[model samples]
Target: MSDRTRNTPEMSQSAASRRVAKVGLDSLDNLWFQVGGTLCNLACEHCFISCSPQNDKFKMMSLAQIQPYLDEAVVLGVKEFYFTGGEPFLNDEIFDILEATLAIGPATVLTNGTIITNRRARELARLEANSIYSLEIRVSLDGFDEPSNDRLRGKGSFKLALNGITRLVEQGMLPILTAVQTWSEAEHERMLAGFKQLLADIGYTRPRFKIIPALDLGAYQQNKIGPAVTEYVTEEMLEDFDRSQLICSNSRMVTNSGVHVCPILIDYPDSRMGESLKATTGEYRLRHPACYTCYLSGAICSNFSSGGQSER
Candidate 1:
């Protein structure tokens, strides 16, 4: 899932059937900004958020709308910040927003890597160069070649993404390439080899790869994808589980709508805690099937985590 899917029948179905597990905020270490909302250039089959060009359930957030959150994050002792969307680069004021964010702390923007022109890469490089904090650009390249990537993304997406990666590489920005896992664990070695070769084709030797898990949302929910979510997190599931590995245990995402529990659950109105960061310090119930992915995969949304990035 990407910046990610929303509203499904899991909650309503489980409401009366059973009690879902809940997680409390250990500490507000990470802050997420839904800068672009659900307005992505490409309508990827795997996006849980179901973000697309026409989907404007939530609108793009301006720097003015985010400044207060940035201020509040500092008060909340937020160690770092993350920027995600349908496609974060789709926003016009993205650079300005990053500039403002970098002034406070490190920031990472999750993008599909299709619209990252040479100019845009240079601007991002400048932002990273100017800041003492780290600026990570995570690009989602679903497959190694055009056929595979384009199948999940769109036609010609592989070429455009390669160009985007090339530009960023030329500017000395090594973006973390994220590919949702669509293959079996047995194919892991083969997939890694192919991905390496793909990066090599574009002169990105020693590329960092983060093979993310495909959550059962959006495309998966509609039977367009495999491994439907049949279970949810229960009290027994969290008995001895390390809650720190969960995003909701230490993160909150701010969208144009309001402050949500986490970036993954923003589509549900119940996920919206309140209008401010203070109101979000409470515990979050793990009702959605997406939580099962986090429970199984660890905090995939975070940069430094036990789960998420496979290597480098």
Candidate 2:
């Protein structure tokens, strides 16, 4: 975890049915594009959205569809852009979209690190080199070793992902390796140390990594691994809390369907805020179980660790 996110406060939950907190949009600091949609190459057991090769609940977004949102976001003073999906690299035009985004502002892509071929790495390096703004690539790996990671991500995923990470490093790109916490809190330090050693063994010294808590949705729910959280954010809880800690207060997601409240709740019907970014700049209610996760882990969607140990 980064120092900026250490020892942050969590939202207080009450059993009383008090008024739900309505978090208002503070500013459009970050804009996320569901470029790959819900289609992904690998289906991890703990995927919050349950994305798979066959899952098309949310379809991919084309450059044409994304340009308008980028333009609108620039006008709204969005500081950065993010691209994610089932697997962003699976999209045919993902590189083009990244290039376009880098032209305007810093961009980040959340990937599984399985599709980064040598040619792709070269192209990405070129794009990053040419852009005035930074281009960050966040690679998802559930565990440090094959026995542990492949158990969740899939067979042979560990080797393939490591190859991709090495290729990216060879291209002079510092990818942020991310993992969802699958072990107990007592194992965190050992896990972190093991991951660092694993990276070093692969010649990636001083690796940047993030540990995220798994959400009790999608695959986790289907597998009956954990019960859904029943807590809700109430008005009294936000009386003196930093409202900016909520992703809803500063971020919006653009998908093929429309603009949604945040990245985590795109599958929820009520999360669909509006048809456009400008129209969606209003208050959002914390009504879903995932809202409790976000409240406990402050803004677990941004690149920088605001108040949560999770998030890239």
User: Can you tell me which runs of candidate 2 are displaced by over 4 Å?
Assistant: 1-18, 305-312
User: lDDT of each structure?
Assistant: 0.85, 0.84
Give per-residue lDDT, candidate 1, residue 293: 88
Compute the lDDT of residue 41 as modeled in candidate 2.
87
> Candidate 1, which segments miss by more than 4 Å at Cα?
1-19, 305-312
Over 1-312, each residue of candidate 2 has an lDDT whose tens digit, in order, gives 001111112224334434777887878988999999999889888788889998999999999999999999989999889999989999999988998899899999999999899999899999999999888889998888899999999898999999999999999999999988888889999999999999999889979987776777777656655656667777887877777778899899999999999998787777899998999999987866677788887767787733432223
Model 1 TM-score, 2 decimals: 0.92
TM-score of every candidate: 0.92, 0.91
Candidates in order: C-alpha RMSD to true structure: 3.7, 6.2
Best by TM-score: 1
Worst 10 residues of 2 by lDDT: 1-10
